[model samples]
Target: MPGETVEASAGSVATRDARTGGGTAWLLGSELLTLFRRRRTWAMLGALALIPILIAVAIIIAGPAPTGRGPAFLSEITNNGLFVGVTAILVAIPLFLPLTIGVVAGDTIAGEASHGTLRYLLIAPAGRIRLLLVKYAGAAAFCVAGTLTVVVVGTLVGWLLFPIGPVTLLSGATVSVGDALVRLLAIAAFVTVSLLGMSAIGLFLSTLTTVPVGAMAATAILAVVSQILDALPQLEWLHPWLFTHYWLGFADLLREPMVWDNFIDNAVLQAGYLVVFGALAIGRFLTKDVLS
Candidate 1:
């Protein structure tokens, strides 16, 4: 019996085949696990969490800000803690959010190649398209995570440091705490979606080279430049097409009737960028040689 080794069972091989054929979910989970496990990811999240804490602390120390003196909804934080999350989002949307998204998305493929693991990943039986989708999904997951970090942390920090009550909308309507919480979550979702275009751009750039830092910088710079262009009066004609144009449109969700025009416009703009850059990344990656 010791000399005659038993052969592998047919069921085992069939099970392995099935797993290999339907492993996209497994791969995505592994990708997200790997992403969140990195210290850099946590560090970025911690930095984001500080935004609200610092805002709340400063407001507490400096006394209530006069209306129209600071960030929108900042003065309101003295009355309702919920505004803290919204105000933090307004502060972060300009640069912090995009900076973090750039790092994650830019590192997607390039990080694997930089670590000399790209070849192994491809040989893991992951099709290029599948792998690319998983990478984007991972980046997208980080977007959600990062945005929620600010919102939830901001809310908690605000609650501990400020009063909680009904929030007044810009349109002269007040809403209950429960309704305001829903709007805060909606704002977070809008902020997350706002970063997708940058994510796609970063992913495409990541495929261009093995230098993750370069891709990250380019992605961040593009975000800054887009905003600058959006701010230029002479370039007003191009504002509608710019990805950053509708970023702050999350304010629409806070309105009494809740305007949907900006939300719809931003979603359409982001989707267009996703399609164009996603296709480009796919084309470049599928044909490129994976030397690493």
Candidate 2:
């Protein structure tokens, strides 16, 4: 009987440890579920999904967009439904998408701290390193999910309203419809990867202050400021380092032979930002006092 009781205790410890292990897989699941339950999360996703609808409606009404100075994809969308999805993603990624990411990333930790919950969360066996990783993962997940929302919704809207066929690339070459679909998916993925740097920046800012609002605003400002700097003629030397610099490299995915140079550079640039800002967040998070 004593042996049986000891076995039960050991099993219980194992189960608890599974949840509290270095992997912290259980905590990650719970946090993600919690994140999805927030109304703001749904609101952000809904806003993203709405972008394509608005674009589709506007173009459907405006006719062929002058075919010259307007949006590059405008002339193609009515003919190829897939471009609707691509254009929506292209439009949203610049501002609305990053702003939404900033709001969520900034709130992840700071929200808890401001609400007097960070201390309690840390009081548990969860390591700061583990918690920080989970928070940032949640933020990145939002980025991917948000980007996907625009793509899926836009594609559906386009398929319903416009003719469905092969997408015409900026180059004169034409590919099969199936190939175009794949390229659109790749473009969506590229857009998501491009935002990793922004996600890292947002997550780092989130760690700076207990005020979630401040963190959110500061993160958005950083993105906007980086983009502004990227546009300066005299600051061409700094373009390579800016988070927004290579964002439009998705345009390459549409080209025949699939241009890899700019695309690879963008990925490497984002990786650098991810490493630097991610390290900054982890370092600061580990040492900072959690008075809230």
TM per candidate: 0.92, 0.90
Kindly list the per-residue Cα lDDT of model 1 for residues 1-292, writing each as its tens digit.
3211111122122224335765888777767767776668899999999999889999999988898988888888888888889999989999999999999999988977876667767766778998899899999999999999999999998888778998889899999999989989988888888899889999999999999899999999999999999999999899999989999988789899888888888999999999999999999999999998
Report the lDDT tens digits of candidate 2 across residue range 46-77: 99999999989988888656666555686788
User: All candidates' lDDT scores?
Assistant: 0.86, 0.81
Distance from true position, residue 13, model 1, in Å? 21
- Model 2 scores worst on lDDT over the 10 consecutive residues at 6-15
Q: What TM-score number comes out for model 1? A: 0.92
- lDDT, residue 144, candidate 2: 89
Give one clash count per candidate, in the order shown.
0, 0
Clashes of 1: 0
Where is model 2 more than 4 Å wrong at Cα? 1-23
